[model samples]
Target: MGTWGTSIKDNDAFADVYSEFFDFYNKGGQPEIISKKIIEDNWEILEIEEEKNSLWFALALAQWETKSLDPKIISKVEEIILSGVDLKIWLSLGASEQDIKKRKIALDKFLEKIKSDRPKAKPRKRKKLKTPIFATGDCLVFKLSNGNYGGAVVLATDNNPETAYNLVVTTRLNQSNKPTIKDFQNTEVLICNFGQWQDKADVTWYMPDLFYKDYADIYEKIGKISVDLEYDNKNHDGKGYLFKPSWTACWGMNNAADKQFESELTKPKPKKTLTIKQLTKKEKWWKVF
Candidate 1:
């Protein structure tokens, strides 16, 4: 819907549909199956008549490149183009006469490209899987800002070296002395609720970056749990994973591997709290509450 240019890839829907098609294709999905799934998954895109053009154009281009162009898809695009419905929609969206002319030219070129036969199909690429540094049941410990230590358990891994991350639960053992392997297994995890630390609502993070064996100066592997995972699974003891874990993730790391734990150890995230004096700017406002 957000159209900044006249090119097929200029629109948001086109880029999304095109990328998804290739993603499934690279994963060894059959072209017909991938096309159907893409249509089903993004059925909403087809609802808006204006947006429908982007999806069909993207799908057509992808299919053409893969040498699997479908007649029905080509026919749909052709109908939209020749009928001039796309240009009318553009005019409705307040496009200039010049821009509409350019879009029509682009559409004609696109139709010609897809209607032609490709000499060869583009090769399907293999998707690289991410692998985790620590195992599912591994116990980990990291230093906190107050010279105390924080505990964590590696609940699961998505087997990706970079992307698929480690699923971990931080423990509540904020301690000054170093804890042994036994301590990690016995302690309760930090649970957040109503923005404060407490009950049923908790946080489980997907961390692509983590402290590895080399970063033992600040973080280290203590041991493993899970007679079969989940640190809270009642199958292990009595308290299973009853809490609904809130999930979050971080993005755009330059080098997640070498710098994950090292950066945290050197400069950890600071926790700043405002005391009454700081809040009152050191004034005698204790009676103002």
Candidate 2:
């Protein structure tokens, strides 16, 4: 838990940084020259705010502290800080509706000042949006270790499942070369559905690379694998895949999803048995010899 006094101190530390930047700007010094060093020093300090509260204030502080050392920069920083203060006041202590209204008015004035002085650039044209390759309510293919394959239906909405989605599949061979889809043999494919809010839907896949060691291995082989999928969205035709054993896939979310899948995998499997009469019938057939 953090105290109110700590928040005040953090706020003051940010203010001091803003003051120093303002001083430099007023002196007609170049702020961009020291921007990198200043940012490195303040990164941890920024984390303090990021952990304790909203990142909006921290971003404003960063913008102020790193703005070009010029008169305009100082003015922009002050405007941003004032706007942040207004936002904090509104979110912190309970204020009367009238007080909220008044704060918003002041905040609007500060924003107007910022807009008047800020540099303008050409507006970017919007690109056409494509239907996501992976989406919610779609069946996904995954490889297992026994020279075989498995699949699951994607339950959560995935606006960008290829990059943002997390998943958990049952198999071994953390490395790509060791266990290809051919390794998954005689293993039952267990499919589980998870909602967007479910914790299990958040696992990410990790891969190995010589240069970038932190990368996750999402794709295993060069060739594509084909699989069937069912989609909730109506516009796109639902089922298709490119080739055999498409790529190494992993859940994109947190470890919680992995744990959930493991629990599901651990459930008892039903056993097969033969009755005595059936056994006797087989014996009778052998007795003819």
Candidate 3:
């Protein structure tokens, strides 16, 4: 979350890394210039976006494909194993379960090969969150006890869900009548597109059926709903969300989506049909056939 979060703002560098990663994959699985050291040095940038999952796993795959390995390379491989990124997320990158299994085996063997050369370091494991970190631009779908369903875009994420749930969601509803992060239950969270909110005038509430049907393919299961993420008025003597006085009514959300909502809702314009008079004689004659 340090420098890794900031450096990906450069679109050029992002595109280069993305294309180079694919190119490296195509030419050979071996990492010639993009060694473990290079990845380690630029770790902040590489792991900046959601692409971090892909970047880490790709390195693992490339390492496995390389024919020869030195102690230094093995050490770097070890660093990858110790990195907190989950190897399973590679599945989301189109890797099959069998391939992931082989990758794990290869990683294990590589680690064993270098055991004598370097002492084993403690593995850095990621904490199993009650709910996965709901980062900005994530999609959230919920079905409450009332049996209604709807979804929204995550405007921001709260790393620590203990003290306060830091979910700032951007909905289709106007800023005046939007649901706070607390107003959900039996929630089903999905890792949708890397989209953000933009252009307030464009925001409007979308019915449940329309949304799920339209964007059905992009959603992936990330985690479950937190039972108590929303603040309860009963618990804090009628204090609202985040225990702030201003949040006592209408929750803390206000015109949050007015600024903008950058999402995948841009529908393509329909192709215009040619009128009979506008068509050439030859084209019209062919159409008759």
Best by TM-score: 1
List where candidate 1 sits over 4 angstroms from the true fold.
Answer: 128-289
Question: In model 2, where is the ten-residue run with the lowest total lDDT?
Answer: 241-250
- In model 1, which range of ten residues has the least summed lDDT? 250-259
Tell me the tens digit of each residue's lDDT in model 3 across 52-152: 53344334433444433344645554676566233544444333465467656655664564444333322322323332234444445433212333444
Please list the Cα RMSD from the true structure of every candidate, rounded to 1 decimal place.
15.9, 19.6, 21.9
Q: Per-residue lDDT for 154 in model 2?
A: 31
Tens-digit lDDT track of model 2 for 18-74: 434434444554556544444565565556532222223333433443432344544
Q: What's the lDDT of the predicted structure labeled candidate 3?
A: 0.34
lDDT string for model 1 (1-289, tens) is 3223565555546766776788788878888999999999989989976688888998999999999999999999999899999888877755557768888889999989999999998898766555565777677777654566666666666654435555655555567888777776667644332111223322243433322321335457777765343333223222334444433232111112112222334544223222211211223568578
TM-score, candidate 3, is 0.24
What C-alpha lDDT, on a 0 to 100 scale, does residue 246 get in candidate 2?
12
Question: Top model by lDDT, which number?
Answer: 1
Q: For candidate 2, what is the total of clashing residue pairs?
A: 37
Which residue pairs overlap in candidate 1's backbone?
130-159, 130-160, 130-161, 131-159, 131-160, 131-161, 232-240, 233-240, 234-240
The count of backbone overlaps in candidate 1 is 9
